[model samples]
Target: MTVPTAVLLARDDVTIRRFAERDADVRRWTELDRGGAYLALEAPELLAADVRAFFGPLASA
Candidate 1:
């Protein structure tokens, strides 16, 4: 079985993840929703901040 990279990266468990401010409005933003999956969520700003904090090193590198 071969799973696509997009599938591997797409967030599955929402329990530990959320959407970013600039991306929260995206319909099925994740690869998991590729087939016309749409969704909306609140508090996207926090998610964005958290993402920055977590991946800041990569950007600087």
Candidate 2:
């Protein structure tokens, strides 16, 4: 599915971030080598950074 479809699936009250893997197939979705499907498990630091980035603005507001 496209990014738009994924965003639409989220709750209206939620904010979504779209990130496409640099080496992923053009027709499929793939995660980074260091953090694939299990983002938090494979790369907790990166995942936490992303989560913070996504919500940081809201927290300041």
Candidate 3:
């Protein structure tokens, strides 16, 4: 599969991480994933804010 398709369709964290490890260009997604996970554990309110910022517009749809 193509990199864009793989990145867009990936839902499993392990799969995403593997892709990131194999592809330097897609590494930011992995970084974001890790940052999000860390925020979830260490600062849930911040995570909530990020979720809102990232998904709030979609909520209207």
Candidate 4:
């Protein structure tokens, strides 16, 4: 089957990492598949918020 249609709606790496480091499947997390869950939550506004959340801090950094 083809890859599922999903987007971060968000793509903040640190956030994604934090999430994965949390209750996520630590050992096999995204090994066989990429961050499909992140991909699955796609929405235009959320993606924008994610971008802003990341870049806002990055802009200062």
- List lDDT for all candidates, in order: 0.34, 0.40, 0.43, 0.40
Instruction: Give the number of the best model, judged by TM-score.
Output: 2
Candidate 1: tens digits of C-alpha lDDT, residues 5-57: 11112233342234332334322223332212122243344445545555565
Candidate 4 wrongly placed segments (more than 4 Å): 1-42
Which digits, one per residue and each the tens of the lDDT, describe model 3 over residues 1-61? Answer: 2233112222223454664546553412322333333456655665566556555655575
For 1-61, candidate 4 gives per-residue lDDT tens digits of 2322122322343345555445443322222122334543544454555456545754575
lDDT at 47, model 3 = 56
Among residues 3 or more apart in sequence or in different chains, the pairs in candidate 1 whose N, CA or C atoms overlap within 3 Å are: none
User: Which candidate should be chosen as best, given lDDT against the real structure?
Assistant: 3
lDDT (Cα, 0-100) at 12 in candidate 3: 28
TM-score of each: 0.31, 0.43, 0.35, 0.33
In model 3, which runs have C-alpha deviations exceeding 4 angstroms? 1-37
* Decoy 3 TM-score against native: 0.35
lDDT digits (tens) for residues 1-61 of candidate 2:
3231111111122222334323232232223335455655766776666556555655676
Model 4 poorest 10 in a row by lDDT = 1-10
RMSD of 2: 11.9
Off by over 4 Å in 1: 1-40
